[model samples]
Structures are given as C-alpha cells and as structure tokens.
Target: MTLKHQPAYIIKMRAKPGQGDRLFELATVGMEKSGASDRFVIAREDEDPDVLWNVEVFRSEEAKDAYENSPLADELRDEIIGLLAEPPMRIPVHPYSALPAAPS
Candidate 1:
C-alpha cells in the first residue's frame, strides 16, 4: 500500500496582553469551519504569556487554500491581527513516513 501524505501549516503569534483568550476564541471558530484534520496551540518557553504557536493539518494543499480563503478564517485573521503586537509568522510543511523501504 502507498503511504498518504498531508500538508501542514504553522502559525506563530505574539498576542497583546489579555488577548490570548480572544485569539483562541477566534481560532476555534475558524478551525471548526475549516474542515482541518487537526489544530492546536503550544505555549512558548520563558513563560511568555503572549507567545503562541498554532499548528494545523490538512489533507491537501487545495483544502489548505480553501481554509485560508474561508470567510471564517478571514474573520479570524482580521481579529487576530488587531490583537497581535506584530505580524504573525507562518510556515508550511509536508510530512511523510517511510514504509520500511518496501521490504527491500
């Protein structure tokens, strides 16, 4: 059997004080509508309350684009932009696992 691969997106943001909750709320709404396989946030070290990292996985690049262009995502972007101290950083990733060299 062939292995399946999926695209992933990572976003790092530094929210303004007291804005993390609001960002989380906006992301929840957008994620619910994006049809993504998974999404979540990770807190940075150094106890930087404002620093957050979000990771989202999609089945395909088309799905990722659809999610990015969705109205809900647009709204979330707008909301998060207003609450961030600086622009959010984003990275796209494609991950795969080998199948034991196909038994040689």
Candidate 2:
C-alpha cells in the first residue's frame, strides 16, 4: 500500500509584470504533460497578481526524480527563466493530512 508520505513539493514564483497570465497558461499545460505530479494545482495571489503558486504531489520520489531529469524539465527551466521576476522558491514537504479523492 502506498503510504501518505510520498515525496511532495510546493513552488512559489513571482512573474514579471504583465506575464502572470502567460505563466499560468504555461503552468497549466506543463504540469499536465510533465508526468511528475499526481496532483497539481495552481493558485494566484489575490493581492499580488504577479505571484503564482504551485502545489505538486508526486506518486513517489522516483517519479519526482524522473521529472527532474526529463528533457521537458530542462526546456521548461529555460522557458520559465525569462518569465519570472526572480528564482522560484521550492519547498519540499511531508504531508500528514492530504486526503484522497472521494469516489464519484
């Protein structure tokens, strides 16, 4: 059985002026295709439109590492460098209360 303590991460980033929407678009597409995040969510800051946050849940540490080593990751790294105001801050997390989705 998969324990609740799968490797997870949260990334907080700030976009350049007028690029928040574009960044959001890219994140929506990129995370979906990355094959890294089992659960991914994007949220925008209410007070600061340029601020964007991502919550990612990987199935395992290996899955997360696979994503880190992917060509797409390198590509996105290059792509995002131009879009951000500064380097993104990534925080590693250990979850104790992330509930699974309910049956439909």
Candidate 3:
C-alpha cells in the first residue's frame, strides 16, 4: 500500500454574530479550492450558535503547506476573517495508524 501523510487538523472558532453560515461556506470553499485535504468535516457547536468546528485530514505536510500558500487563502482572507469573532484555532496532529492508509 502506498503511504500518505497523516496530518489531522482540528479547527474551532466563533463566528461573528449572524455569520455562522458564511463562515462555514468559506471553510468548505477554502478546502475545495486548496485540494489538499483527504477528508474535511464541518460542524456547529451544540450550545453556541456562533461556534464552528472543522476537521481536516491533509494528505501530507507538503499538501498542507501548499494550502497555506494557495491563492484562495489570500482571496478569502478578509471575508473569512471578518466573519470570525476571533482568530480561528488550529490543531495539527500526527496519527499512529489509520484506515484506507490514504485518502480517496
């Protein structure tokens, strides 16, 4: 089996008032435009209407780096940041094992 990057990233943030949907949209768009993720999941917090969460599994560190350098990031920089109540939190993890071994 071909080995792949196992970088798991978790992002949690609070959207600006009435901007939850916009934030979520931007999140998905960013992922779609980057083409760097193996899996991407988005969700809202149970108790906080403004809270947003994203789980992204990137194919590799190189993939993630490419995403950071992507033009999409610059394109949405203002809009996404404006929709956020504060800076988003990003957590990166290195996994020991995973199914599929590679993202489809």
TM-score of each prediction: 0.75, 0.89, 0.81
The TM-score, computed over Cα atoms with residue i paired to residue i, of candidate 2 is: 0.89
| lDDT over C-alpha atoms for residue 16 of model 3 | 84
What total of clashing residue pairs does each candidate reach? 0, 0, 0
Better of 1 and 2 by lDDT: 2
lDDT string, candidate 1, 1-104, tens digits: 12236777677888888887777666666767667544444555368767777766676777777777777777778888999988889897754543343454
lDDT of 3 by residue, 2-91 (tens): 233467788898988999988888888888888888777788898987898888888788887877877777778768888888898989
**lDDT of all the models against the reference?**
0.70, 0.85, 0.80
Q: What is the C-alpha RMSD of each candidate to the true structure, in Å?
A: 6.0, 1.6, 3.3
Clashing residue pairs in candidate 2 are none
Q: lDDT by residue for model 2 over 17-74, one digit each (tens)?
A: 9999988888888888988777877999999998989988888898889988999888
CA lDDT, candidate 1, residue 81: 95
- The whole-model C-alpha lDDT of candidate 1 against the native structure comes to 0.70
Q: Which is superior by lDDT, 1 or 3?
A: 3
Q: Rank the candidates by lDDT, best first.
A: 2, 3, 1
Model 1 pairs in collision: none
By TM-score, the better pick of 1 and 3 is 3
